[model samples]
Target: MSVQALVRWVAAGLAALVVSAMPMAASAQQPSKSSMALANEILDIKGSLQIFETVIPGVVEKSKATLLQMNPNLFKDVDAIGNDLRKEFAPRLAVLREEIAKIYATRFTEQEMKDTIAFYKSPLGKKILTEEPNFVDRSMAAAQDWAVKLNDEVLQRFRAELRKRGHPF
Candidate 1:
């Protein structure tokens, strides 16, 4: 997959995991430090925080692509600039991680976060961690195939309706 596509897929997968793991209702009060710590631990166990690692690089790559498209002659300069920007923005990844953890902290109680961490560290959780990517990939492919078939069915129905109206073309 292209870098951009891979980045998008990772981001979607991360979002899905986070949403599924969090509680439906968020706390009105600020998250406690203990809850935040547990939330960070949950992220670490799931390796979800790693998803944000690509954000800066992806942005740099897209910017580089756009600049190159505008002035192909500056390819070398653009590459250098992109590399510099990646390093400069790398630290911002921590901010994203903190924000994600805060969301988790607010959505789940400290006890719940602790239980989640325990579950993730178990054998079943390890198995899930290993297998989820494959499952998601296959599921996405199946959905795409289904959509293609649905599109064909819809088109056929549209044609039938047009024919009934004496406007088949």
Candidate 2:
């Protein structure tokens, strides 16, 4: 795939991952009876999983933006594409949520999940949860810039060594 396409794919994957890793709230209203039970709490009914809620829609928006950039004329109907994208992906959300929760259930003990939930409900935890998307966006940009610079430096050295050995790209 083209670099832009790969980057967009990776960005969307990372966004979904980060959202999945987010701890569920442990407030009294959002308490979980068990780890298994917690695993089933895809949403807490009061918009508690706001971050999770954003994953699909955010990805859809990003996909639309990338398509527009790639072929502005062809994708001039961005709203139509965006709607179709949402329709295509919306059905798979439950499966994704179940898989994420299953992974969480395996990785965390009942008490640990509870503790994590509690932590996320606290002031500092809530702040972190709320700001995670912004953090991820800035970090991804910085990392991509660094990777491009580092890749160029490394490739220059490698190509020079290869040319010295009578090989060229």
Candidate 3:
């Protein structure tokens, strides 16, 4: 796959993980400060926050592309400004981190967060963490290939039915 396609797939997978982790309902009670702290620790141990590292840069590049499309001659200026904006907006990632932690804090209790952190620090958890990317990659590829075969089967069946009906298909 192309680098861009890989990046998009990874981004989408991470996004789906985040969405799945969220609480189903809004909580009337806010998470305690200690629970939030535990949630942050869980995030750190899981390295979930690393996904946010590209947010600022991606936004900057997208905006630069939009501007460059209108004024192609301003490439130099747009590039410089994009770099500056990346640095300027970098701190906004903290806000996203906090919001995600809040979601975790709301979904899981403080004890659960502590358990999660402990698991992540354990040997089995470490092994899973090391191997999960490869597992997910192979699983997704297998699923995609299976889907393609199933689609071809369905199309062939449809063509057979159409031919039976005197249609060219």
* lDDT values for all models: 0.80, 0.64, 0.80
Compose the digit string of candidate 1's lDDT tens values, residues 2-117.
55446556867677756754563444567888999999998888888666677679789988999899999999999998888999999998887887788888778888898899
Residue 96 lDDT (model 3): 78
Ranking by lDDT: 3, 1, 2
RMSD of each: 2.9, 8.6, 2.6
Task: State every prediction's TM-score relative to the real structure.
Answer: 0.86, 0.53, 0.84
Model 1 residue 53 lDDT score: 76
Error of 1 at 24 (Å): 9.4
The worst-scoring run of ten residues by lDDT in candidate 2 lies at 23-32
Candidate 1 RMSD to the correct structure: 2.9
Write the number of the candidate with greater TM-score, choosing between 2 and 3.
3
Residue pairs that clash (backbone atoms under 3 angstroms), model 1: none
Candidate 1 worst ten-residue window by lDDT? 20-29
Give the alpha carbon lDDT tens digit for every residue of 62-147 in model 2. Answer: 88888888888866589787888788888676776565566566556777777777777788877876676556566767888999
Residue 47 alpha-carbon offset, candidate 2, angstroms: 8.6
